[model samples]
Target chain A: MTADFLLSRYPYVLIAVLFAIGLYGMTVKRNLMKKIIGMTIFQTSIYLFFIQGATKQGATIPVLDPELGPSAELYINPLPQVIVLTAIVVGVAITGVALSLILVLYRRYGTLDEVELLRRMRESA
Target chain B: MTSRFESIFLFVVARAMVPLIQVFAFYVITHGHYSPGGGFQGGVMLAASIILLRISLGEESYDRFPREAGIVIGGFGALAFALLGFASMAFGGNFLEYALAVPGMGAEELRYWGIFFAEVFIGFLVWGALVAIYDALESGGVE
Candidate 1:
């Protein structure tokens, strides 16, 4: 795309770039810890994308105001924020679980390297 | 690990800060209904306080919270939330219908209390569960 197009949709471009970086980390990293970091990055990009969607061009927050009254057009979408909130907790919970499992794996194999871990598993079996 | 030497400076600073953190966490939980924060955010704060203590003071830091207390508190919070729903149902109301849970109280007041209690329980559950997870990760006693 042209510079103008990219500049006009900077948030989207940023989201795409973040998504790519996260994907790269997840797929190309050797250490399991790095992969987890990549996974967290990927998740962050998705969250940012949702947050971007939740905003409106001219609308304000979802909170009610006496002057603004109860007009739907005056407020930004609230559902996406709620969704992101719940998703964040779930993400953290899963991340904790994943980290604990990784801890156990390292305890057993004595290595965080993905390839080394696989090799050790085979040797033990 | 538990074998690591304890730092007096770390312990003293963490001990001093833990109370402030917990107080703020309580404020966040209680004022959540009218503000941006709610149960999860406050609960995470509580867990973070514990984590700070754990990092600085080591195993002995768990004296206040304890390892087993995490799951117990979390389970109690979960049970409270569930009971709130069932209690409403027992009053011949649909699930979570707080207005019906109380026979004569106004609908608005009942609903407010219901949501408030829900937030409280949610905060407790999140705080305890997160602490438990952190403990598990730290211990890694999966023989």
Candidate 2:
């Protein structure tokens, strides 16, 4: 990529790198908590990606402005923003569920390491 | 959740801050249609205030906002949201079509109030659900 293009497109690159890091953490991390943290990072990067798609160079919020004439182009696209907003809540809920499941697992097996947890589950089963 | 070290200063500050945070949350919910804040944002703020209290007061936070209350408030909010949709339906509007539901006000006014109420309901639901999740995590699915 050219230097000027890279400079202008840093946000997309940053989001991609974060998404890769999160994916690596989720897949490669041994600790369950670390995995959850990775999942959070992944979720955040996705949200950021969608938000970036909704951006306009000089557009305002979705709210109607009386001063400006009724032009559709005056506002940023709101659909992605709405979707991301809902996704954020759902992501938090998922995190809560995951953490609780982890808590139960730790209580049962006395371990948070994935391999150990798997071994203990097999033993109990 | 309890730790050995506790700061009386944090406790008092948390106590003083909770009400203000809650009031601001309410403002955010109420002005959501016209402002940057909204139901979900307000609800998160409400949850934050509770979390602040929980961490600051530790065990002492129980009587103030017991664990049972969380799920109840959340359920109530969800129920209210559904009920409002149903209420609009009963009044001959399709689900959530507020302009055609209530008769007295102008159509725009009716829609505005409908949206306002919906925001409030959503705020309550989110606040309660988050608090419940926090409580469950803290106590490990116990009471």
Candidate 3:
């Protein structure tokens, strides 16, 4: 019975697992690059959750079909898709900026390990 | 980096594909109203095509679009978008209120043109900004 419930609600379960993994990577990873990868994974999970929520059984794409009048029920929710699209672009921009900053930091400190970076920060101060 | 990998096959393929990708990007931007793609997605694709050429052709890619032009184009795109918004306001409407942006045009036509122009500006901005970011990163050092 529990297995049946799990299968029926598999999307949420998958989302939860992805979120946990991303969180673990972000918090437990010691390398700065690893943290950036984790951040990307975390963003991926959120995008997946939003896109999944936007899906509906027997619903068509959000594009308007002239044959089938403009009925809200006939189409999947478009707002989430639109929002996620913008979010994806913003996420890319954020990642690009973050990577450039990391590159600068690496140049200055010659290390990408988080603990080492902190030590160097203290030494510099 | 460009000189390190000089393969005729890669060069030919990249050169051939760039134009096709650019054409598709324009199609996506223009047909966005009736399709899944829009300015943002199309703009990214356009940037991707140029980046592909840069990666494959190396220093030669700069001949197509000089490195300095990237940032200038990006700034221009953003300025165009802002000017459009302010133009609407100047015409006695709220910011981005397309209907009031143009005088004496039918409401529907005004809306269509407004959205079309907005998408074009956004496409230009995104394309330029992404290319500039790539150029900045690809160039060694923080200078």
Candidate 4:
């Protein structure tokens, strides 16, 4: 019974754990890459949220077919899939932009450590 | 990070798909209501196209769109969204209420068009904002 319960709630549990880990890393990590990784994890949890919300029992793709009558087994919400696609693109764009910014930071500061870079920047300022 | 052959293959494939991806993005943006896509998806796709260009061609290639233009694009998106909403009001409806905007057109079609146009603006805004943020980060460290 307990196993079944856990299985049913797995998506929520996963989201919570992923969020916690992402938040922890974002807060505790000093490396820019690590922070970016944390951000990615955080964004990924959102994608999971949308997907989980849109899930249905025995659902298939939202595509239509004349042969398949209106009475299909199920149909997962296409809205969420579409939304997640946007989120994924946003995540990738942010990551790429962040990486390039890091490259520039490294070029200017000669270090990837956020704290050290901040310190040098402050000193220079 | 992988072998040279794999890396080269990936690069070649990505290069080959840039135009295709761009076309797909436009299709998604235009026909979003019919499918599982909209302006936001299309916008991201557009940005992804530019990003792909950046990855494939490097920073030197991005000079095609000046940083100033990106900022303008961002503004244009906001303006476009607002104008869309306001235009509905001008047509004797509440803000963003597309149903009353164009009585001649079907309500669903009007909604679709509104969303599509808004998505265009959003795409431009998102792309420009990203470029600006990157530019800012590069010019000054985020301390």
Candidate 5:
């Protein structure tokens, strides 16, 4: 019974662990770059969760095979794959924008340490 | 930024590979209907090829495709996509109703064309936007 439960729930457990790690990194790390990396990790966990949900035990890939007919049950759900594709592109865009903002912040402040940057901002304000 | 690497091997291999990558990207976009590839995947691949050239060849890469040009191309692609959606509205149908937009074509055929054109526009938009982002990052955050 334990083995069966583990087999059925391992993917969710993995996702939860990954999300916890990302959250820890984002909240506990003081370096801005590390925080950005954490954000990436968080995004990755969500992607993995979506992909895991889309998988089936006996289903094939969501490709059309002439011999297989057009039965939807024969293939995995394609909607999640499509949504994840767009999510990945959006992730890249978000990362790029975040990095650019970090670049500007570093240029103006000369430090990537979050505490130091916050102090600097307070001084300026 | 104008520094060129002095490696003959890198230059020759990259030059040869760029065209092949571009051809494959086009194939992915055009054959998306029946395959695993599509507009976003192909566009990223196209952008990857250009970025490879930039990384290996340095400033000379900008001579072929300027940073400003990328932004303009990206804007045009977005405009094209929005205009296509609005064009459907002009034909007295809801947005993106491709059959009504192009009268006299079979509904299925119109849908096929609509998806194709949308993919093409998205391909261009993604390609140009990614390249523009790369350019901006390389320049080290807005002059």
Candidate 6:
């Protein structure tokens, strides 16, 4: 594709690549930490998607600037920013809770390797 | 599987990039109302930044994560949001009725303040929670 076409679609391409990498790691990695990394990457890509979607050509800052002439023709939408804020908080809370669970799992299994840990848990349980 | 070189280059780079990304994330969070970025995207970026740091440094280095400050930050964000909501009530409007809360404030100003407070909550939560999760895995691995 030409550069112009590429620029227009680049965000989606980035999002797709991010998703692919994350999914591959999550599915194939034997380490629990690796899997978590994958998940985080996956989640982050979605955030990127939302941010990109909200952006439009030639949009101005939502903040009112005195420098802009009284008849300036543009202002950006602030709604997406508001939505993303809540999503970020929830992601953090979920991360905390997930980490706690992982800790518990570790205490029980004595290992961080996901496959080995799972095997041990099966045996013990 | 990748070699240590790959890990050092890619993974370590990931780690190093996180803090920078996080600074940008904060910028995005605060400036979001005017730009394409917003609270959710910025918050996630913040979490991802720290998560990258953990990945590159390994879990042991997570002691660098600030627990108390994170908790306080998150609490403050939520508190700020609550206060914004309640400000409307105090100003003889329904809760979260930004338009009625302040006669002197423009409608846009009230909206911005309300949104900013909400975004602050997200920022704190993202910072606090991501570190917490990383801690969970790190502690899990070490023991």
lDDT of each: 0.87, 0.90, 0.87, 0.74, 0.89, 0.70
If both were scored by DockQ, which would come out higher, candidate 1 or candidate 6?
1
Docking class of 6: acceptable
Candidate 3 wrongly placed segments (more than 4 Å)? B1-4, B101-104
User: Could you tell me the lDDT of residue A60 within candidate 2?
Assistant: 94
> Model 1, A85: alpha-carbon shift in Å?
1.2
Segments of candidate 6 deviating more than 4 angstroms: A1-8, A67-73, A85-89, B1-73, B76-80, B90-92, B98-143
How big is the RMSD of model 1?
2.0
* Poorly placed runs, candidate 2 (over 4 Å): A1-5, B1-5
Each candidate's iRMS in angstroms? Answer: 1.3, 2.5, 1.6, 4.2, 1.3, 3.2
For model 4, residues B1-143, the per-residue Cα lDDT tens digits are: 11123366656886789889989988887786566666677776676776565555555445665546666777888788888889889888889887554557898888877777777777677766665655454345444
Give one digit per residue, the lDDT tens place, for model 1 in B1-143. 56324677777788799999999999999987767788888999998998887887777777766889988988999999999988889888888887454567788989889988988999999999988998888886767
Per-residue lDDT value at B53 in model 6: 61
Model 6 lDDT tens row, B1-143 = 11123354766577668778978999988987766666667766876776666556664434766544555655666677677778778878787776554668888888778778777776666566555555545444444
**Model 6, residue pairs in steric clash:** A61-B34, A62-B34, A84-B40, A85-B39, A85-B40
Better of 1 and 5 by lDDT: 5
Which tens-of-lDDT digit does each residue in B88-125 have in candidate 2?
88888888887454457898898888899999999999
Q: Higher-TM-score candidate among 1 and 3?
A: 3
Best by lDDT: 2
- The candidates score, on chain A by TM-score, as follows 0.96, 0.93, 0.95, 0.87, 0.94, 0.83
lDDT of 3 by residue, B39-129 (tens): 8998899899988988997888888888888778778888998998888888888788874635678988887888888888888888888
Q: For candidate 3, what is the interface RMSD?
A: 1.6
Q: After superposition, how far is residue B9 of candidate 6 from its true place, in Å?
A: 24
Q: Judge candidate 3 at residue B97 and give its lDDT.
A: 83
